[model samples]
Target: MVENRARGNTANAARPGSDAGVLVVGLGRFGASLAATLDELGRDVLAVERDPDLIQTWSGRLPLVEADATNADALVQLGAKDFPIAVVGVGTSLEASVLITANLVDLGTPLIWAKAISAEHGRILQRIGAHHVVYPEHDAGARVAHLVSGRMLDFIELEDGFTIVKMRPPQETHGFTVGESHIRKKYGVTVIGVKPPGQPFEYATESTRIDAEDTLILSGDTVLLEKFARRP
Candidate 1:
């Protein structure tokens, strides 16, 4: 049985490929969190979940349907193809994840974001037309590894080893302007911005002085950035 709680509000109100709304499949931890965040951002989201209990749990919180996304018919009935963006958060089971992603592709969903438990699973999702494949657990673990070092305040790995990090200015950088330090020439990392203690963040310039109490935002190859952060 398929149950749609968005009958009146979203049934025909949103146009296909419109940015006004999104279609989210599954109600697991990731799915639920995505839906809630989208809601908080003021975006209309239609969440689809197979379990009746999960549906009931999120009933008043979000507009959702009780249907198995692995079934293409259920997605069609829920108007999945009408949304410009669709997210498949069924990563617990590889088979189910693949089926849901494939179904979204068959429905011609414009953009698909699917979660994968492993690299192989992500590759399969990509081959099946998922626009973005995310490995949440792997990414979280990697992010934690960087933060645990105590030197890196935050880290964001973009692609192909390129990364951005927020950290304290190393001792060598303190008490000197960016031009005098020649950090990029010596360490291959560019200090993009700096936030002095109790002051607003400002873009880094050759004249910008680095103080010991300031936090620096730098971008470079991950390996080089780590080496620079380790400076005594």
Candidate 2:
């Protein structure tokens, strides 16, 4: 059984206007990074790890529960059921990730995010009730492919056939007002914002001009996005 190291009763941990915080299972790179980022963002975070030594290493930094996250009772004992969000981050262990996700689901956690080793693993996670499935390896590979292709500065796939992309404005479109570019009419994409070199992002408007090095943030259907990307 893991010791309950939460500052107070799990049911009462969240104040009236505050959230119940997040529960991170596993202590690997993904879990650690999520926990650290949540803590940095001023969220309450409780981390779980099978290895006591790892918890000791992270002592004084994050609240922790030393136990096997794959065990449903272990998680229940840690008061994980009350957390608003639960993340299963045992990237290399599909079984562990699935088990933790199942436990969180049974606990009625509002949101569950699980890391998957492959598409099949992701499907299993979703079937077992993980609200979000992340494929870090696949996503990284896609990002690298985009960068190597020299068309995309950044990429986010919102769904199967829609994407949000950041890329340099087409050379021919330079010196034209945003409305004059006819991007929506010509390419079927929406320019949401512009990023000039060394400056903050500026939301696009009718009068915004496209400069030589300005990057554009756009959203559109996948086919249209690919067509737009292939442009020089």
Error of 2 at 86 (Å): 1.1
Q: List the residue pairs that clash in candidate 2.
A: none
Residue pairs clashing, model 1: none
Residue runs of model 1 more than 4 Å from their true location after superposition:
1-20
Q: Give all TM-scores, in the order shown.
A: 0.88, 0.82
Give the TM-score comparing model 1 with the true structure, all chains together. 0.88
After aligning candidate 1 to the native by TM-score, how far in Å is the CA of 180 from where it should be? Answer: 2.1
Winning model by TM-score: 1
- Candidate 1 scores a C-alpha RMSD against the true structure in Å of 7.6
Candidate 2: lDDT over CA atoms?
0.81
Per residue, candidate 1 scores C-alpha lDDT tens digits across 28-132 of 999999999898888889999989999999999998989998999888888887788898899989999999999998987766789888888888887787777
- The reply for model 2, stretches above 4 Å from the true place, is 1-18
What digit string (tens of lDDT, one per residue) describes model 2 on residues 1-232?
0112122343344332355588998878778888988888888889999878888888788888789978888888998877888888887877788888888989888767788878788878877877678877777787677666757788877666788899888887799988998899999999999988999999999888899799999999967877787888
